[model samples]
Target: NAGVTQTPKFRILKIGQSMTLQCTQDMNHNYMYWYRQDPGMGLKLIYYSVGAGITDKGEVPNGYNVSRSTTEDFPLRLELAAPSQTSVYFCASDSTGFYNSPLHFGNGTRLTVT
Candidate 1:
């Protein structure tokens, strides 16, 4: 099964353009996350959902939004994109109630806001 898949592996957006990074996991994990990595800065959680119809903000929530309609899908939306938002976005998921379960990650979507 495709553990986690993200669409549009790369994209470039204008300062005011917006886009949604699509993520889906086939493992039926109960927990999913959206994270971003910047130069010299480690991964920062953008948003996460413990389950369907329930979501929460992470370390950096501004300029971004997320929705978890099903355990298999989690999409991250970027509104009015900016240069500051340029980074590699990743989607990950892990099964709940399991300590040793591997965290599955998408290949990552490289977004550049020019």
Candidate 2:
């Protein structure tokens, strides 16, 4: 089974546009995270959740976040999009909360805001 999958591998958005980047995992993980990577930069956290119905903010403010409501899906929503939001976004999940638990990652969704 695919550990994790992200939809719309590439997308383009206009200023003020809004979109949801879909992330799903078949591993039934309780921990999930969203991250964005800019050119020549490291991954910047966007948001994360320890389990369904719980979510926490990260460094970047993509927009308001929501609880997964299900362990298999975590969608990142971007509102009032701007050029600065352009980047490759990644979604990851860990079966256990342990620091050393293996992380499963999606291929990544590339977004461009014009």
Compare the candidates by lDDT and give the number of the best one: 1
TM-score of structure candidate 1: 0.95
Q: What is the C-alpha lDDT profile of model 2 across 9-79, one tens digit per residue?
A: 99999999999999999999999999999978899988999999899998985563645989999999886
Question: Using Cα atoms with residue i matched to residue i, what is each candidate's TM-score against the true structure?
Answer: 0.95, 0.94
Q: For candidate 2, give the lDDT.
A: 0.90
lDDT of 1 by residue, 1-114 (tens): 778999989999999998999999998889999999998898999999999999999999999999999989999999899999999999999898377777789999999999
Runs with alpha carbons beyond 4 Å of true place in candidate 2: 62-64
Score candidate 2 by TM-score against the native.
Answer: 0.94
RMSD of each: 1.2, 1.1
Q: In angstroms, how far off is 114's CA in candidate 2?
A: 0.4
Model 2: ten consecutive residues of lowest lDDT: 60-69
